[model samples]
Target: DETALGTLHSNRSAAYFAIADYANAIQDADECIRLRPKWAKGYFRKAAALVQQQRLKEGVTAYERGLVFEPTNAAMKAARDDTILLQKVKYVPYPTSVMAPAKE
Candidate 1:
């Protein structure tokens, strides 16, 4: 039951991340991790949210922590590697918020 709830939260976090709503994505991913610490997916979601929010080091740490719990999770391992590779490249984050015209 707890895992199921955590999965729901993780799924919602992914959706929020897809929309560039990194703040809410982090919140939902945090809850998922709290609900299911043993689930690799929860950690993956949290790490993804953290990376999107420009906290790359923290996100990689989260991935490492998750890997400790599931050493053989291929998807998680791939995600971790991808995150590292992305960090190595010069990343220019896209603006997620619209800007208003400057006041005269």
Candidate 2:
């Protein structure tokens, strides 16, 4: 049963993520996505691992792809929005005062 196998891969991906093993998580997520192309969970797992790796753009792309299959997924939508914000923040410069040494 391909679907069951896909579920198992997705579960493994989640386990890898829990252990902070992002590369393996992504690998398992990719397998799950290959086995179940229409399943949003695989994409979600991939996106999460990518985000943890600081690959924000790739994470956003994965989330967008998942949204195509489940447009009304609120959790995915929130995560995607948060990632977009994080990406924007990454390029923003901190205020000079924020980086200044404190006075004694």
- Clash pairs, candidate 2, are none
lDDT tens digits, residue span 1-104, model 1: 88899989999999999999988988998899899988777788889888887788888988998999999988888888888888877476645554555669
lDDT of 2 by residue, 1-104 (tens): 99999999999999999999999999999999999999999999999999999999999999999999999999999999999999999989999999999999
Predicted model with the maximum lDDT: 2
What TM value does model 2 have?
A: 0.91
RMSD of 2: 1.9
Runs of candidate 1 with Cα error greater than 4 angstroms are 90-104
**Candidate 2: residue 41 lDDT (0-100):** 99
What lDDT score goes with residue 58 in model 2?
Answer: 98
lDDT of each: 0.86, 0.99
**Residue 104 in model 2: shift from native, Å?**
12
